[model samples]
Target: MSRWILVGVLWLAGASAAFAIDQEIAFSDPSMNTRYLSLIREIRCPKCLNESIADSDAPVAADLRREVRRLMGDGKSDDDIKDFLSARYGDFVLYRPRVSETTWALWAGPFVFLVIGGIVFWRIVRSRLGQPLDDEESAA
Candidate 1:
């Protein structure tokens, strides 16, 4: 029974080791590899809400990774590859999408809201100052 237990432990360890293989794609040019890493991290996984391609394990992420590798091997520029993916997946695929007629609102919405909020805040403060405080409120 002790021998069987030892065999079971060994088998479990070996099975885990077999499944621990790291899958990495290497390029002959170090620059190409660096660009690949950067692109993966910069590209969002379409199937995931907020995960990058580098961090996502979705089937679409895997397909995108393979496509990126193939595009790089074909000597496509980083921008060219990004444009191709954008064309297929829309600007959502990019972490920082370029500003365009369609995306102008996305880039400017926060600042516009901030200015409106500031104006509203100023008006509220001005109106409050114009009112005389009640005796109880002033005492507090």
Candidate 2:
């Protein structure tokens, strides 16, 4: 019976330690909480693209989330935090990269391609639907 009691105490202590280690940030100012949450949501987990760091359970994501909180506590603004993370992790860490000369293609290339594709598709459909002119029109 003494051995069982000892084991039970050990188990409870271990459980509490585990819980303490996983404790999340508790913001002193509620406004900071909103900013912190927004920053996390904009950050992508390198390991998990489908989930934001805020929603990811991966260890790396958790560490990144904690790092963001630390930066916020240190009075870093949102852009400063983003720039720090981007410099360390690259633009891939950002869920949405800003459009600029450096990233112009990344931002606008897709839409350009879509427009080109739509033009080609429309031409194909129009030709199939009897919109193609005859050789006489071409000669004129």
Candidate 3:
């Protein structure tokens, strides 16, 4: 009976805590609220590395959320908000970084790597299986 009661208390505490987190800050305008949600999901948390501000529970994520809300309240345009964050934290803060001189490497690096890998893989497969092995390879 004691164990059961403790389990019940734990369950309730977990439920309440989950609800307490990620409470949306109310906005006077519906459009602003929509922008707020989008901004949080679009912005990366420096502490969490790959996770968005919306998905991160880090203290820095919380601060970023507050800053987004404050900027929206000030009637800043979405581009303005993005530019401000980009300037302060660098392009790493944006989920889809703008294609600029500095960010070209990030956007193109993956496709370049993929093409190089594919070429290497093709060469390896061709050499190994494209035809019967040469006499020297067969001997080895």
- Per TM-score, the best of the predicted structures is 1
Most accurate candidate by lDDT: 1
Better of 1 and 3 by lDDT: 1
What lDDT score is found at residue 15 in candidate 3?
42
Model 2 per-residue lDDT tens digits across residues 32-112: 755666678899998888888877889998889888888888999989988989999888898889776789899889899
Error of 3 at 18 (Å): 12
Clashing residue pairs in candidate 2 (N, C-alpha, C atoms within 3 angstroms)? none
Model 1 C-alpha lDDT per residue in residues 1-140, reported as the tens digit of each score: 99999977865554443233216444546567657777888999999969888778899988898898899999899899999999999999999889999889999999999999999999999999879999998999
Which TM-score value belongs to model 1? 0.61
For candidate 1, the 10 contiguous residues with the lowest summed lDDT are 13-22
Q: Which residue runs does candidate 2 get wrong by more than 4 Å?
A: 1-25, 100-102, 109-140
Model 3 — TM-score against the truth? 0.60
Model 1 Cα RMSD, 1 decimal = 10.3
Clash tally, candidates in order: 0, 0, 0
Where is model 1 more than 4 Å wrong at Cα? 1-22, 109-140
